[model samples]
Structures are given as C-alpha cells and as structure tokens.
Target: MELQTLYNEYLNIKFKRGLPPVRTKPFEYGLYADDSAGLFLTDHPEETFTNWMYELIPRDPHYISAPDWQPVLADVFQQMDIYDELVLYYLLFTLNTTLSVNSHNAYSTMNDFMKNYSFLQLSHLSEITRLNEEQKHQVRDFFFFYYLYAHPVNEETLYACSFDGQNLVHTKTDIPLERYFTAFHDHYSTNIKEYTEQIAIAPHDIQACKHLTLQLLQCIEGKLAKLNMPEEKGLEAVLRLINDVDQMLQLHDNNKPALFEMMKNFLKEARSTPYRDHCFTTLLQNYASYILFFRFDEIHALVEYFEDTPEWCRTIINKIFMDTIFMERILRQKRIDITTYPNVTQFFEDEAKRIYL
Candidate 1:
C-alpha cells in the first residue's frame, strides 16, 4: 500500500480512538514511524497504541526481512535510497554466520540510520568484524559509489536505526560504541580511492570540507599530544604543517624544498616584529610530531633530504615552525574536535594513511 493511503487509514484509527493524529505529511509517514519509536521507550499503554499503528504502515523498502534475505538484498539494491550495501553485506554475512555463532544473536545488527540521517552518506560505518580479501574489494566499491554521489547537507536527521526486536521499544542497546568505531574505521580505510576522489571532485563541498578540516587539526593535535614540545615534537610538527600547506597550495612534490625555503624566510623576517620571543622550537616539535604520526618513515627521508640541501636542519626547522604556527591558527579558529564528531573520527582513520603513507 502507498504510504499516504496507509497514513490516512492510520489517521482515521487514531481519530476514532480519541488519540491525537501524528502530525506528519504524506511522504514523511515512514520517518514519523521511526521518530515515534522514542515515545515507546516507556512501558505505557500508549506504546502499544504506537506499535499497532506502526504495524499498519507499509514496511520500509530498506528494512531487511531475514526470512527471505536474498530477495531483501535484491530489493535493497533495486531501491538504493540510503542503506550502505557494503555494510549491509558485511552485517548480513556476519550475523548469519560468525557473530551468530559467537554471540547467539545477543547484539543488535543492521545499519542504524535513525541515529543520524546523513550518517550513511557522510560517515563510514565501522567494521568490527573481519572479512576476506574478496569481501574487502566489494566494500571498497560500495564506498566509492556512495561517496561519489554523496552531497553536502547543512543539517541532517536520523535516516534509520539499528533495531533489537519487533517492537521499537525493545531496541536493545547491546552493541558497544567501540564496535561501531571499529566498523567506521574499516569502512573509511578500505575506501581510500573514493576518499581521494571525493576530495578532488568536491573540494567545495562545504560539509565534507568542514569535516576534513577538523580532522586535519585533530590529527595534528593527537600527534603533538604524544610528544614533548621543542625537544621531540618540533620537527614532527613542522613536517605536518608543511604537509598541511602543501595540501592547501597543491604544490608539486619536487617544489616542496622551495616551499620550505619560502616559509623559512617568512619566519626569519617575522622575528623582528611582535613575534621575536615566539617559542618556534616548541612549535616545530609539534609540527614534526604530527608528520611522524601519519607519515612515519617518510619524515626520516624528508629530514635527510633537507639535511643535504642548502637549507639544512636549522633553516628547514625554522621554515616548518612558521607554517605550523599558521596552520595552528587556522585549526584554532575552526574549533576542530575529532573526538566529538564520529564522522570526522572515521574520516581521520580513513585519510591518515593517505596523508602520511
């Protein structure tokens, strides 16, 4: 039955019973049903009234019916609204086999879109379980397609949610947050190709850019937090700052030395101004630490390369400190906090390898 027709019937039933009709437009009935689930959290009789109304509504096209899993899978593919196929595949495969064997269906399964609407579109679902090589390839493709078509949104609602049992009230919060984070990390990392493509194609995608900017700063901070300032973190911070600038400037790989020199001169000149006592040594340490966190061995090679150039360790260190300070200002202004934003956290895990490796 059409959602509108079902909604009209539902309205009539609610009117007859003296229950207030759920305020919803025709197209929004499904969302209303999902939203109303929260109301049923209490064991009041109103919860039963809600469950009855939900049953009357047509099933969501994306809802998985385990009885006929194959057809359901086909239906999901046939109507590609928001469900992440790759995630679904993994969920199904694991639920039907591995996790089922271990947990005996103790935990909740399925992509929980109701938590956040653009979640599936903007964030990568974490992979808590393991998969074979073939499965990895399939997931990679899924990520590529979704991200390629994904658009920026100013604000988003919950698209769907992971359910525990028949009645929405029975939504068992058995799945731990860590599992979700792991799953998100897997999804993001596997889709490296798509991540790079999205960056190049949607450089102006405001939401994605905002998320990425925060992620960059978070990465820098995370690396810096692990080291001592001026002693160990200085060069590490500098390298990362250089990387951030290179990414911003789109500088050619071979021209990085020139970029370093330019930044070095800029810092040297700034010393006579209001910045004479600036703790550049500490700043460079943080910058270098950030680079080492992501790029590892690459920083060693970069350090060696700079050592042989006319601008040796001291000059290169000075240059990177200036860039680090500039990048740090931008990060502070942006107010980046990856820990607060799960999507940004996922993006960091996915893009960290690309930035450094």
Candidate 2:
C-alpha cells in the first residue's frame, strides 16, 4: 500500500484505458475506476501525481535523480509551500550554486529537459483542483512565487503576480478629440463658475481653489481643439499646465498669493509678446466676462496682474475668441431645427433629453 505503488497502479488503471474484471464489490470497483479516470485528466496530471508520490513516500536523497525529477519539481514547486522563508533561502542557494558552478551547458540542458516535462506537470496540477481550500492555497502560493522567481524580468509574469495579489488591472487611453473638447467645455462652463465663486468668497479653502484651478485648465483645454495641435505639443502643454497647478496646490500656505502673483506675471508677459497677441486677447475676453460675472472685486487684481504686458495678453484673448467663435460656428452648423414648439422650456427639455440621454 506504498504511495508510489498506489500512484503507479492508479496511473496504469487510468492511462491503460481497459478496466479489470468487475469485482463482487461493484461499488468499490466503480469508485476506484472513477478516481483513476479523474487523476489521469487532472491538471498537471504527471507532475501533480508524481509530486504527491514524492511528498508521501520516504526515499533515498538521490533515490530519484535530479534530472529525472527536475521538471516535475520545478512545476510543483511553484504550487508548493517551499516559499516559506527558510525554504526559500535554501532553494535560492541551491538554484544559484547548482547553475553557477556547473558547466556552461548545464543551465540550457536543464531548461531544455524541464520544457519537455511541461505538459505532464500542467496536467498534474490541474488534477489537484478538487483539493480542499488549504491545499489549494498552498498550491497557488507556491506556483506564484515559483513563477515570480523564474521569470523576474518578464512583464507578463510580473503582471500575473500583481493580479494574483491585487485582483485588479487598470488601463488608460486618450480621449477622442471632438468629444474631449466638448466634455472639457461642458465641465468647465458648469464647474468653473462654481469654482470662481469659491475663490471669491472663501479663498482660503486651498483644496477647493486647487480644484477650481484644475477646472479652469480643463475649460481651456475644452476650448482648444486638440486635433489642431501636434500630439506632442498638446501633451506637453497639458502636462506643464497641470503640473504647475498641482505644485501650486501643494504649496497651500502661499498658494493664494503665489497664484495671484503668477496670474499677474502671466498677463504681463502676454501683453508684451506680440507673437502671442491673438491667444492673449481671447483669454482676456473670457477673463473679463468671468471677472464681471463672478469675481468683480478681483477685476482690479486682474488688471494689476496684466499691467506690465499689453501685447501678450492681447494674443491670448484672441486665441480664446477664436476658440469661442469656432465652437459657435460648429454649433450653428450642427444646430437641430425645430419648426414648431408649444413651449420653449418644454422644447428645450426634450432636446436636452435627446442629446444627453
């Protein structure tokens, strides 16, 4: 009733494909037959079963040559408790010493030999899925750590390790140009007003002020057509703007004063830059309108900010104008015509629902 003898018998029963005579005890024979079939088709059928034998059976240290057992060992080790600190230390030492001191061909030969056993090892692991929770956890942890050590530089392997640990993956992609601009405009127009109001009433609320600054940037982005800008330029502009705002927010103690000073310098520089006159003009109009509506007291503050430069501010204002005008043209071109409406509010409500919902 040795474990190896039992495994060999089970393997023979399963892989040989012919059942022995039906015994008087039909139920026992049926159960054995079922178990045999299960083992043969199990994940890593060869490795799992062989490892099970190795673990359960007491044998000479070199009873099974390393070459003969290396493949199954490597495969099973991944799913083993051999990652325990003590075990890991020993395993690392063994792997390093064996490969380093051995002949140059030793590593390749070992790898080639291991590759040939992959199918069996995989089958063996699959067969053990029916094991209890504790057993399964041990198997999974072993395999994970094993693969981690083996393929340390492989991105996919690293991803698998993190996935196993965190159970989540994140992906990022560029927003479509047209939709990006529209979304930016919508968000800016809605949120920037609220943000500007916060700045006027409670400027000390650093977080809110920071959020508002970000919303303004988002608004500016919405106004600018990303498609018109070179990809690198667009990316660079966004990154620089965002980073500046973020850094300003992080320096909360001096942020409000710093922000005001920065805005002043920006306006001054804008006014002096003839080449950027159009962009300045557009920004100025938006600022003027925004100032008049929400932060009238800050008008003088803004004027002071812009006093040093005339031409650069004019360019910025012109750019803002172009954006607004371009957007207006696009809207007019794409406007939905409604010849008849009983009530203006109801008409708008329906139109809004159609477009948004």
Candidate 3:
C-alpha cells in the first residue's frame, strides 16, 4: 500500500473502529478468519439494536490470529500519533512487500512506477526500521526513483535527499517520507565550490565571497529544521559533508588558508547572530577536532576567542578552563604526552591563573 493508503487507514482507525474484523460483540465472531487477520478495532462500542459493536484492529502488520494482544490507545491519547505512525510504517513496508511479490509478473513494469514513488529520490531521509540490509537498499532506491520520476516532492525535500540504489546513504533525520536529501547536498556542494573559486580569485575580498557559502549554511539550518533527512542516508550525508570540509582543509595551496580564516571568522560572527545554531556549532566542532590534534599551539587561540561563549559552545576550549586537572584527564584517555607542546604548557599556565585565580 502507498503512504496515502496507510494514512487513510490510520485516520479510519483513529476515528471509527480501530481496524476491521471489528465487533460490538467479540463473542459472536470468536476470532476473525481471513487471509488478512481479523484485525480488531478498539474504539468505543456503538450499539444498533441487537449487539454492541466493540473496536478491533490488527495488533500489528502481521495480523496476529488472536485479538488478546491488540493495543488500546485510550490511555496514551497524547502520544497516539507516534503509535499511529509506527503502525502505519509497518503497514507500508508489509503492503509494499506483499504487493511487489504478488505482482511479480507485472512487477517489472510496475516497479519502474513504484521506484518513482519511494524514498530514494529526495535528499531528506526518515528512519525505516525492521528491514535487513538488502531490503533497506532496495526500499531506499525505490523511493528515490519514485520521488524523482513519479511524484514531485517539494524543492527542499527533493534536493535535500540524495539517492543511489547501490549505496545505503546513511542519514539521521525524522522526515524520510519520499525524500532522499542528495539533491540538497549537491546544491550545497555547488555553492561551496563557487565560494571556493571566488575566494581564490579575490582572497582579500573574503567577506564578500564568504557570504555565498554562509548563505548556504544559513539556508540549510532553517531549511533542514523545516526539512529533515533519514537514518542511513543522514549519517552518510553528514559524514560526506564533513569529509568535504576535511578535503578542503587538506588543500595545500592558497584556498586552504582562506577557508580556515573564513571559518574562524564565522565562529566569531555566529556567537552574536541568530545563525548561531547547530549548523554553526557542528561545523565549528569539526574544525575544533582538527585543531585539537594537529595545531595544539593554536588551540590557545580558540580558547581565547571563545572565552566568553557558553560552556556547551566552548567544548575543547571549555575543557581547558576547567584547570589542568581536566586536561590531564583528557590526555590520560587519548594517551597523549603533555610534555610535547611548550605553548600548551605556558598557555595553560597563563590562563589557569586568570581562570582559576
């Protein structure tokens, strides 16, 4: 069944009889008998003249033969939608599987149409559980094909999701219905590239060129919150995005310094701007991780920069302020000798007095 079908079924259960094979009198039909299990609805009973009809529905997608285990949502009305969504998802996967297998003869042609309807086409992904690796791959691909070719999703959704039948596109968002998130990432990459090129040509004009990248960054923050991504693909997209940043950091020529400098400037600017949200912090964290190990000397520079920022925002810099004891604890875990960097020693001492004293 498609999402629409599942949604309709959800509404029906929410409003009327929970599911079919319902009964005002459970005693009348002992148990439901059908290819599809006699799902029971749990809605309040409605009586005509003879028997009182009780709600009954499938306990789950599998349609267990018995109704004893069927859930009652009466107690948790506030969180009812969460339950409904989970159940609907189960219905979606099961029905998709059943229909696909049933249409084996017509599947080849229908599949082309089906693929255009599934989660593979968009950049934003949602979590789809209870599937093995192969099914996960196929479902993702199918959705991508479906989204791009069949139903047209919104621009944010279409572009935010990335889809490739071969790869599992690990993502981490909650709105993966008919979205892939690759499309958005591709556009982001394009913008980043443009910014890089422009920055190279006019290095001194960093302020102007940086806005192109900044705009992309700012857009995604609001856009992603308004938008979202998937589990498998979400992870992949973030890793790839960070990797892209890392790749840029590895640039041995002129662009490398400019990029780093711009990032440093961004960190400072974000502290005061509304754009100082997760997107900013996440990128900042990535840069900090790089600086932590490679540029131990410059670590103090960041510490000094974020001296007034929040503890959560300070991170490694914050750790430094907790006194040498904290650094010792961290060094103990990473097994890095504290003796290697003199700047770190002097820097920590100078600041330790200012902070601790």
Q: How far off is residue 199 in model 2, in Å?
A: 52
lDDT of each: 0.29, 0.29, 0.32
Error of 3 at 166 (Å): 14
Report model 3's TM-score to 2 decimal places.
0.24
Q: Model 3, range 123-177, lDDT digits (tens) per residue?
A: 2222222334554454344334343332223333234334333232223233332
- TM-score of every candidate: 0.20, 0.18, 0.24
Superposed Cα RMSD, model 2 = 33.3
Q: Which candidate wins on TM-score?
A: 3
* Model 3 spans > 4 angstroms off: 1-243, 252-256, 267-277, 290-330, 345-357
The digit string of per-residue lDDT tens for model 1 on 145-207 reads: 222222211111112122222111101223322233233334434444556632222222222
Instruction: Please write out the lDDT profile of model 2 over residues 147-265, one tens digit for every residue.
Output: 33332323422333222221211111122222322332243344544546222222222222223223322222222111111112213432232223223233322443454454445
Superposition error at 235 for model 2 (Å): 10
RMSD of each: 22.4, 33.3, 24.6
Q: What is the Å distance of residue 56 in model 2 from its true position?
A: 62
